[model samples]
Target chain A: MSLLRVDDLRVRFTTRRGPVQAVDGVGFTLERGEILGLVGESGSGKSQILFALMGLLPENATLDGTIEFTGSGPTMVFQDPMTALNPYLTIGLQIAEALPKGLDPATRRARIVELLTRLRIADPGARIDQYPHQLSGGMRQRIVIAMALAAAPDLILADEPTTALDVTVQADILDLFRAERRDHGRALLLVSHDLGVVAGLCDRVLVMYAGRIVEEAAVDDLFARPGHPYTRALLATVSSLAAGDSELATIPGAPPDLGLPIAGCAFAPRCAVRIERCIEARPAFRALGPGHRAACHLTKTPGTES
Target chain B: MTLLSLHDVSVRYRLAGGVLTAVDRVSLEIAAGETLAIVGESGCGKSSLGRAVVGLTPLAAGRMSWRGQDIATLDPAARRDLKRHIQIIFQDPLASLDPRMTVAEAVAEPLAVFEPKLSRAERSRRVAAMLDQVELPAAIADRLPHAISGGQCQRVAIARAMILGPELLVCDEAVSALDVSVQAQIVNLLQRLQRETGLSLLFISHGLSVVRHLSRRVAVLYLGRVVETGPVAEVFAAPAHPYTKALLSAVPIPDPIAERDRHRIILAGDPPSPAHPPSGCVFRTRCPDAIALCAEAEPTAMALPHGGRVSCHRYEPSGQAPAPGLFKEDPLGTN
Candidate 1:
């Protein structure tokens, strides 16, 4: 069985303006041991989908979807490690809580220390007793990862796990994720705003905008020949040290407010190569190649797909 | 010509633990029309240096000069005038702006402080013009900061900063909080303003890619010190310091093929506390190329072949000849 599957997931929140559809008609499948990446801007509903899956959304949110997970329950790692952990708990105790109930005290402590050491926390013995405030940001993040992994589940969901960290420290945490996936055959669904990070780590990429998946492909294909205009713009405008002082191209205007229902294409207003049909009707997912698809009317069929 | 110069500047904080040197003995110069980016990991003091340059934080030591005039020695009137030329925009646009104030009031506050003699009509006209310059709609001037989007709030912040025609602007992670497309818009806006005004920028940020895109010169900081500083292209192409090379390698390229093909230099251990850094080199604890000499004595800045300077034992003018470029000899290496 697939590790997780969702069909026609929709999330709406009752707001003073109106009902905001945070995630609309989103559907995807994650096979066992597959690292999938979900990327989008602030209101793209990437994080909302994670919340819906974990059943952690607020009271105002009204969700209509079917999520089928084969595991007991999937664990999640939030963006901020400082808040994810309790301030009153010691680092070791928090991680130990994730383990099976009634685990021998010595064994639990040893396993917790081992996880910390694996994540490259120095002197795990001394750090196991330290409070979350005593540790630095990077170290605290490692401890959070350790806590998330203490249960040793098959799938992990990470939402911008390294966004608050420094670039150098982010590298270490990403390397740790790579090691975890490789060594234990663990699947991870990572949501982040950083395309660069998704490129390096994720096997498959999903570009979300306006609460819908615009494009889906293998990481290389997504980066190489993005069929959706939004994905293409995102890849083009990424600043690089090697890219000289050429004027950076930008998508003009802001994302559509979800309070009001969107008509046809959500990106048509800002899309440079939008077609007349884009406003008349919404585009369905078209298979561009093997395991690659995009929801854009402009994407030519079969001929351009490598 | 050097528009602003900082000589051996230092910033220290008295905390419960001990005195923390947030910025250490850092000397830098920004030309009249140049953008100089100071990049480092968190707690490496990039923001502190920016804060010091704009007088947001009191300096523990060293001096600053504008157009060769000592800023510290200036009388009250001259100091107030100098303040008009240098302005700072912070990372969080909403936090930097007053929540209660309408966009117009926030942008006009600077003018109210410096040019109070101006008639209300003239100030209102200038505020409207500034908003237009930042591409914000005139209608947004009356809205509270929360009513607009984060991108719009940032545009409002930019409007406020540029209202006074400041010559020197210190942008401390100004675009880091925005989304990708919005960040691009703000970057383009900053670029347009720089060309129009010849504004010098002390662009302090941890994001290397944006720094490279905006700044002509770049400085790499490690534990409150400049490990390397040079022209952006030169330093990025051939970094002379170990920390610089590792930092550059850590930033993942958006291209999948490039990322997979590139070899990464993942440094070990979390960043050490700045209160009591390592004895010799603050970065040696995590540096991959640390040698015995690194622990004994600190390395001084040495000139590079590409009009840059780096502090490392390998680049010691004696025999080692800088291993920063050596590790990157492999093909298609991002480092």
Candidate 2:
């Protein structure tokens, strides 16, 4: 069985101005032990999908979707380690509480230390007694991951876990995830705006834009052959050391507001190769290859034309 | 000519129990129209250094001189004038901007403070023109920051920072919070403005790719101290410091083939706390090439054969660093 399945997911919020269709329609699946990436810009609804599944939306929000994960309650690693962790609680108690109940105090302590060591936290013994406020941002982030993994859940849902973190720290976090997948074979649904993180860590990717999945493919195929213009534009902006005097290729306009009604393709306004049909009609998500799909008129036929 | 010079600058913050020195003794210079990137892991003091330059944080020690004058000790009138010449764009535009104020009002406040003599009509016109330069539509001038998009709000922030035609701009993780496409837009806008205005830029960011694309020179910081500083091309091509090599290799490149083949120099353990920084060298706790001298005494900044400087015992005479060619070539290929 697939690790998780999400179908026709929709999320909306009742704002003072109007109703915001935060997530129009998003659908994807996660196989066992798979690392699937949800890539999008802010307000593109990538993070919303995770929130929708976690059922953590506010009173003003309404969700319509099916998140089928039969194993157990999935764990979540939110963005911003500073705010995600509680300031008042000690790291040991927080992580220990996440463990299965009925364990002896010694086992709980040992398990917490093991989890901390897995996150590459030095002095786990002493750190267990410390509070969240005492650790650095990097160590705190690792603590956040440890808390998430404490339950030994089969699936992990992370939202922008590595965004804005330094390269060394980010690499360490990525390494931990890779090790988890290798040693335990736990499935992960990672959301991030950084293309580098997705390119390096994810096995498959789902490109989201304005509350919809614009493209989906295996990691290699997506990077090698991006089908959607939005994906191509996003990939082009991934600056490299070799970029010399050349201007970064930016998408012309901003993402459409989710509050107002979006007619037809949400990305039509900013797309470089958008056709007349793109502005008038929403394109169907069609298969471009065995495991690749994109919701673009140009990509409908696939390899035929740009 | 050097537009700004910082000598042994340090920024310290006082906590309840102790004094936390965020930025250690660091010195550097920026030429007019040049972009210098400050990069490091979190808590490495890149932001502190940037904040100190823009006067947001007071210097605990050392001097930041602009045009041969100490910025911190300048006269009140001179300081106010200096504010016009030096502007800053923070990381979060939405948080930085006043929620109650419209885009035009927020961008116009700087002009009102510095050039109060301008008529309302002239002020509005200049605001509109600045918006156009940042590529934000004039129609949204009356809209609140919440009503506009994040990318648009960032454009407004850039517009406000550039309205004074400042000689130097400090971008403190300016585009780090934005989406990739939006980040690219702001990066391009900043580059375009720099080209048009010839303004010196102190670009503080952890995003290496953006740094590589924007900066002429780059400084790698570790535990509030600079481990390496050099020309962008030379540093990335052949990093002299072990910290620099690890930092460059740590960044994930957006290429699948390379990702599979590349040998990442993954640093172990979390970064050491700045409050209890290791004795002798700040980076000695994590430096892969640390020798006995690294733990016994501090290594001063030494000029490299390339156009940069590095602080590492490996470069000193009689120093023995066991690891040689320990790092694999960066998969991004420093071409």
Candidate 3:
């Protein structure tokens, strides 16, 4: 059985302008010990979907469909290390707070230290006494991760966990998360705008756009053969240090306005190899290969798969 | 001949207790119309060097010459005139661009300040032309910064910067704040502008990938010093300095399978404080290659066989090489 199942999850905000359909009929399943990458541009409803699933959205937000955690509720780790943890609370106290209701203080503190030490947090004993402001950005993030893991939750939702960190620190953080996930057998939902981070951490990727899943594939397969035009555009858009001074060809147009209700494909306007059929109607996500599916009108036929 | 040259240019800020050497004696030269990226981690003085070139920060010592003219010696009026030829695009578009001004007004402000004789219609026409060059919609001219996305705001910033047709564009972490897709859009746009205008770009960024995409030449800075500088291809293909190699290895590629087996040159400690850098090499404190002599004297920036410059004592074999037991006694802690 899947550890978590999100079915037709639609999130909307009742703005003064109109109801903004942020996550439009998005669906995905996470297996135990699996790392699922939710990749997309800003305003693609990536963070919004995670927020909705965690039940942490703003007061005005309204959610539809189902977010089923077959196990326990998924604990979340935010991107910004400084902002996520309370400035007033010590690392130990914040981590201890994650302990289930009515847990003895001694047991909770012991578990906090154990988690911190395993994560290779420096001066585990002394660090427990330090507030969020006392630690480095990377250390603060580790503290947050430690807190999230204190519950021993069935799943972890990391929203751009390393974006605020330096490159070297980002690598260490990824290593820490990977190690923890493997040891604990907890599923991970990694939401990041950087495809590179997704590539490193995720087992399977679900590419989101305009609050919809445009493509879903195993990481290796996705990089090797991206079926969707939007996916192709996104990959080509990345500037690599290995590919020096080479012009990164970008998707020409901008992302569609979420405010305007769309009848056709959300990425149709920006897609370079878009077709007439793409404009008239939205395409269904059809299975292309093992654990690979793409939502595009162009890839409907067997011969059209790329 | 080099378009701009910095001979041991150092900048220091006077703090309450002591002096902060933000940019150490850094010497580099930018060839005509070449994009030279100054890449480094945070607090590495990459931004400070860019700021120094624009005369925003007073230099403590050394010389900075632009087109054979001593920029430091230029009068205030002449320095004011220099602003017309050298433009800068900041990292955060929202922060850099004025909230009150419309897109057109923001683009026109450069011309309004520099070339005051141009009429409102002429300025408007120029702004529209610049917007077209950046591929921004003409309708966005009337909109405020809040109305547009980060990518569009960046285009407006670029358009404003390029409207005056500056020879050198100092992009300080310009695309770091943007999303991957948006980053690509902005990077491509910047490259296109560079080609069309033949603008010499001093692209400053912590991201090596973006630097490799835009820069013909690259310089890696650390604690206010240029540790390594070379052609982008050579630097990325195989970096000489340990810091450069570690930095290159640190970039996460978008592939889970590849990431699992990736070889990372993970440095143990955080960057040392720049305020009172360690004796000898600034990187000696954290360098895996540090030897005995590294702490005794600073390594000179020397040219390598591959045509790159690295300021590591190990790279300079002829110099007083550090003996063994260098880092054994004083190994830096990760914390």
Candidate 4:
């Protein structure tokens, strides 16, 4: 059995304006030691899915889904370490609080230092006693990761963990994540808007748009051959270092407003290969290859009638 | 002609314990209608340099000249005129713009300040034309900044910056907050505006890809110092400094094949504090090729063969030069 399975996850937020369907029937599964990347622009419900899975959504948000896990519940590493960490509390106390109850003071201190040291934080002994403000952004992020890993949860959910960091620091943080996955054999669900980050680290990828998974494939396969128009456009729009002085291909229109009712396909308006039928009926996921599927009217999946 | 030039410009902040040097003796020149990018990580003084260029942050030492005139010696009247010629666009467009004001009012305020003699009707006409130039719909003119999308607000900000016909625009992470597609749109728009108006741009950003895409020349910053500065293609293709090479290698290429095969130069530790920066070289503490001399004395900026300047012990005459392969072969190979 898979380590974790999210079946038909739907999340809606009740606001004064109306009911906003943040995540509309998104579903995926993760195996042990797998790094699954969720790629999308903002408001595409990528973070919402992770929130729902972690049971950390706001009171106004309602979720309907079954998140099955075979081991301990997942712990999350947030995007902004500055805000995620408590300013008033010392780093040692913050990390100690994440540990289980009944641990003695000395034992807790040792564990905190160990966690920090394992994350490659320089001079963990002195750093543990310092407050969040005393450390740099990169060091604070490493502390956040240490807190998340304190429980040693089977699954880790990182939502744009390196988005706020500089590229150099970001590369270091990514290396830490890769190490965590390889060393601990833990499953990770990484949510990010950066396609380069996803392509570099993820074992598999799921492209999200308008609160739904538009496509799913192995990372290498997805980058090499994107089946969905939205996925292809997203890949092309990324300004790679290799692409020199070339006019970037952009998806012309913005994402649909979630508060409004979406009919047929949510990405159809922005999809270049969108057909008339795409405006009338929502396309279902069809298998293109083993462990690969895409929801698009233009793509001809084998054994599926057009 | 050189539109703006900085000679050993330095900016320092008075912190609690001691003084913090944000920008340390940085010098570069931006020509008319040229885009020069200052690329660095956070706390590398790129934004500080941008603010200093526009006179937001006071310079502690050195001189700045605008069109061959000393900015420091400029009288109040001349300084005010200089402000009109140089404008800055911030990272957060919504935060930079007034929330209560409509888009039209925001774009027209600059004209109201600089060209008060113009009639209201002419001002409104100019506002509409500027909005049209930025490609924002006319309907959004009356809407508040919060009602519009981030991309649209950025266009409005651009319109506001360009309304005064400024020769130099200091964009401090202007498009960093936008999505990739929107970022591309804004970058293209800036390029088009630069081409049409002959405007010079000092594009300050942490994103190397965007910097490479938009700027003609690039300057790499490390802990408030300019480690390398040259033509965008030259600096990117063959970075002479160790810090620049590490920064280039750190950025993950979107292409899987390239990203997987590329060798990364991962630095060991975080950037040192600017308040009590290391003696001699700011980056030598984290630099992989640091020598004993690098700790004793700072390396002065030396001219490179390909046209640019690099400040590194390895490039100095007495110091051994890095392997030819390290300076010539491009890490992100030609596609």
| Candidate 4's TM-score | 0.97
Per-residue lDDT of A81-154 in model 4, one digit per residue for the tens?
Answer: 99999999999989988898899899988999999988899889999889998998999999999989999888
Q: Sort the candidates on TM-score, descending order.
A: 4, 1, 2, 3
What is every candidate's alpha-carbon RMSD to the true fold?
Answer: 2.5, 2.8, 5.2, 2.1
Q: Estimate each model's TM-score.
A: 0.96, 0.93, 0.92, 0.97
**Order by DockQ, highest first:** 2, 1, 4, 3
lDDT of 4 by residue, B1-335 (tens): 99999999999999999899999999999999999999998899999999999999999999999999899888999999999899999999999999999999999999999899999999999999999999999999999999999999999999999999999999999999988888888987898898889999999998877887788799999889999999887787777888988888788777677667767888988888888788887889989999888888998999987679999987643353433322235543342
* Candidate 1, CAPRI quality class derived from DockQ: medium
Model 3: per-residue lDDT, tens digit, A150-251?
888889999999988889888888888788778878889999988888888888999998899999999998888888988887876652323343556666
Q: Native-contact recovery for every candidate? A: 0.79, 0.85, 0.74, 0.64
Residue A68, model 3: lDDT of 78
User: How close to the true structure is residue B260 of candidate 4, measured as C-alpha lDDT?
Assistant: 75
Q: Write the per-residue lDDT of candidate 2 for residues A251-274, one digit (tens) a residue.
A: 787778788887789999999898
Better of 1 and 3 by DockQ: 1
Name the top DockQ candidate. Answer: 2
The stretch of ten residues in a row with the least summed lDDT in candidate 1 chain B is B326-335
Candidate by candidate, in order, the iRMS in Å equals 3.5, 2.7, 7.9, 2.4
**DockQ, cand. 3:** 0.44
Q: Give the Å shift of residue B271 in candidate 1.
A: 1.1
lDDT of each: 0.87, 0.84, 0.83, 0.88
* Residue A127 in candidate 2, Cα distance off native in Å: 2.3
Question: Given candidate 2, what's the lDDT at residue A140?
Answer: 85
